[model samples]
Target: MRKIIVIGSMSIDLVVSSSKRPEKGETILGDNFFTTPGGKGANQAVAAARLGEQVYLVGRIGDDDFGKEIYENLKDNNVLVDGVEPVTQMPSGTAHITIADQDNSIIVVPSANNEVTIEYVKKHLEQLDSGDIVLLQQEIPSETVAFAIEYCDRNGMISILNPAPYREVSNQVIESATYITPNETESNAMFKGNMEDALQAYPKKLIVTMGDKGAIYHDGNRKVTVDGYKREVKDTTGAGDTFNGAFAVGLQKEYDIEKAIAFANLAASHSVTGMGAQGGMPTLLDLEGEWHV
Candidate 1:
């Protein structure tokens, strides 16, 4: 199996549950509060590792308790953490999350995560073999994200760019990436005007994930929509990351585009069934053996 390398951030997620969002300058009693190991890169690594992939996470954590827990969480999930480093005198990154009315709002504090610069990432990239899948997100610097895509393009590696938390990305990077997975809102920000036009513009390369509606991509011949599975949603925070990770595993297995998206959607459906980002991710065994294609 091909190794999946996730390059981005490592942080702890502080989550709170409430009946509704408070108004400006208003305070309300929340139902519950908890902390979990999270961050886009860590979540994807755990998701892929849970699905039995040989995954490696490359990023920065802080020299703090949160960082230690994050590292152990990755190890516990069977992810290779040799590329993960701790930045001195920096606190671990964190996402302040509020789960209200079945939806979540997040405020990210990027501390040590900001230390994942291109210089640091290139060192890890040099150690990886060509043809490996390099998964990336917006949690790190935009310049590093762009550089990784170019590096993957030059090295014959497959690049999956999940343009989350919405940021402006260059067209060159978009064109060079093997796949671009963006959610509904993100796709809207990436390509203005018509959605179909955007999908057609990149063919199978641009995958737009619609929450509960599944994901859609243009096959260069026609548009294909992979339907999502219905499940009891306890938390939707990790659904997108689950999809991205599962999709990478599908690609590593050489599944066709439709099959890959279907597998990803299935995994994502299972993700929303539990709380926290990594909590609900399905293991290879949990897929009822459907992973064998």
Candidate 2:
């Protein structure tokens, strides 16, 4: 199987659960509080690794306790951390998350994650061979993300770009991706139209995810919708990341687009039944008897 190379952010996630969100200048008691390793990049890397893929994560962390935790977490999941660097000047990245009624709101502080430069990405990507799958996210610098995609394109690697926390991305970046996965809101932001129109515009190049409604993809000739598995959602934080990781793994295993998307949908659906980002990802063992392509 081809290796899955992830270029993205790593952070410690501080999460709290409450009955309801507080109003302006209001303080309320929360039900629970916890910490976990998170970040779009790290979450996806762990998801892919747990699914039985050989994975490598390239990012930056701080020389703090949180950074140590992040490193150990990645290592524990069997993701290679040789490309991960520690910077002394900045604290590790962190996300403050609030969950209410199964929905979540997040605030991120991009500390050492800001140090993921184009130079840094290039240095790590140079070690990867062609035919590897390169996964990217927006939590790091946009320029670095763009560069990584372009580099992967130039080198014959399959580059998958997941545009989360949606932002303006260059056409060059968009054009360079082998596939682009975006949720409904992100697709609306990028294409300036409804989901139907966006799907029509980039039929073969885009995968638009609709939570619980499943996902839609066009294989150049026709558009197909894969139904999501029904599950009681406990938290939806890392569902999309799970889908992306599973989708990449399917591609690495040479599954057809439809089969890959179906596999991804199931993985994502299973993810929401658990808590936190990385914590919810299902392993090969978890899916052994249930999932088959």
The lDDT values for all models are 0.92, 0.91
Model 2, 126-236: lDDT tens digits are: 988999999999999998999899999999999999998799988888888989999988998988767776676676679998988899987666788998888988999
Considering only N, C-alpha and C atoms within 3 Å, which residue pairs clash in candidate 1?
A: none
lDDT of 2: 0.91
Regions more than 4 Å wrong, model 2: none
Candidate 1 per-residue lDDT over residues 102-148, each given as its tens digit: 88999999999999999999998898787899999999999999999
User: Model 1, 189: alpha-carbon shift in Å?
Assistant: 0.6
By lDDT, who's the top model here? 1
